[model samples]
Target: MVETLKSWRKRWLSCGDTENLFRDNPSNQMQGVMQLKATNSGMPMKVAQRIDVSKFMSYIKVSRTQLNHIKRLKQSGDGIQTKHVSRVIGGLDKSHVKPYGALLEDEQRRLREHWLEMSCNDLPAAFEVLRERKVLMEKSIKLLGLELQQKNVSVLRKVRCDLSFNSFS
Candidate 1:
């Protein structure tokens, strides 16, 4: 299951001080943490006697207040001897897809120029594709302009109300 800070603190602190927790605690902290004892040291572990709290604090990366809080948790000794927790990674966001902007501006410009040149030279038969695209774009622009003009005329006609009332006697 996903472990939160509170749960982590509870589990870690419950391991019962660096004395009981870190003695044979080769599982969780084995990677970067200092192993104070050889599990095979054959000498049974001791706590609070040898570990200078100041030096210990440096290794654990917590403030005195936090350490005191941790000290208060019950040393329930759950999976204290158990080791190895698997990590979970979430799905990638759009940022991860093009993290560095796909290509630099100068490179992108050069690429576009190269692509245009290649298509015109190598694919001469496909010249109609470009021509068709240009034609369609021009047609869309003209249609939009005409629609805008018609809307403006209708709006103006509505705004200028010519109310000529005639009476038949």
Candidate 2:
């Protein structure tokens, strides 16, 4: 199941304030967030007793304000369901659904093998393929140049014939 900020806070906060440090950073802020390893260190609290009421009150006030705001926005709606919006919407939107079926194990293996074969696994062979492609490209370019030259010559011949004929006239 996906973890949300409220759930995460509940989970870690339930463990006690001594074990976790919630910061203002995005990963620790409102909404569902993953448990941060840095903040959620299982090590014994070094400054548990040092926590002042002012600091605790500030956190509580901030959380209460956010909760109230969200409740107002949601107004009469269920408060923050754990399921994603797409899941809640059900099959009405097929956009999230996969277009194709999952591949069979044998087909997946075959594709992997084909990809390995196509990849530059053998350097010498890959270089040879590149060289062949370069040669073919050069040959095609030369052929195109020859064809262009022939067309130019034909056009020049026609122009010369027209000039001569017009001169005689």
Candidate 3:
């Protein structure tokens, strides 16, 4: 019993008693990415925030692969395999794609740039371009609303119609 206790103590000390007791430290620590300096009275101040494009690209690649897999599964009529689909979807959900939200912003910025380059007389033509590209969907209903507002026709009246059958009378 004494020998066993001694052996246990030796093992504990050799392994560092608190090592496994603590949670694993996050790999992406801010200090490693950013340089901090002490301001007045020893307060740490962040100098800059850096964006690692390669990391972002890796995330994009993973998301694209998952999306392609889902699409292929759908096309092949093997969608009944819910486990694979769920795993892919879940992985995508946890990915950085949703958090970034920059894709739509970039598209909108490009469209705005294209619109601004055109003359006032070309406003309709610009809208036509957007429509042709299928970029103007229900999400852009406000644009349609503005167009409708500018027209002399009453949108509400056009939508409302009476249906009646006189055969019974």
TM-score of candidate 1 on Cα atoms, chains taken together: 0.24
Model 2 TM-score is 0.31
Candidate 1, residues 1-169: lDDT per residue as tens digits? 1233455577686776755644555565654233334334667666764335433332212346544544443254443221211111112331123322323444699899999988878677567788898999999999999999999999877666443222321
Which candidate comes out best when scored by lDDT?
A: 2
Using TM-score as the measure, which candidate wins?
2
lDDT per model vs. reference: 0.53, 0.59, 0.59
Per-residue CA lDDT of candidate 3, range 58-154, in tens? 3233567878878888888655487777677675557555323365566689888887766555777878888876754764887888887867356
TM-score to native of every candidate shown: 0.24, 0.31, 0.23
Model 3 segments more than 4 A misplaced: 1-62, 80-82, 89-93, 97-103, 110-169
Candidate 1: misplaced stretches above 4 Å?
1-122, 162-169
The candidate 2 region of ten consecutive residues with least summed lDDT is 53-62
Better lDDT candidate (1, 2):
2
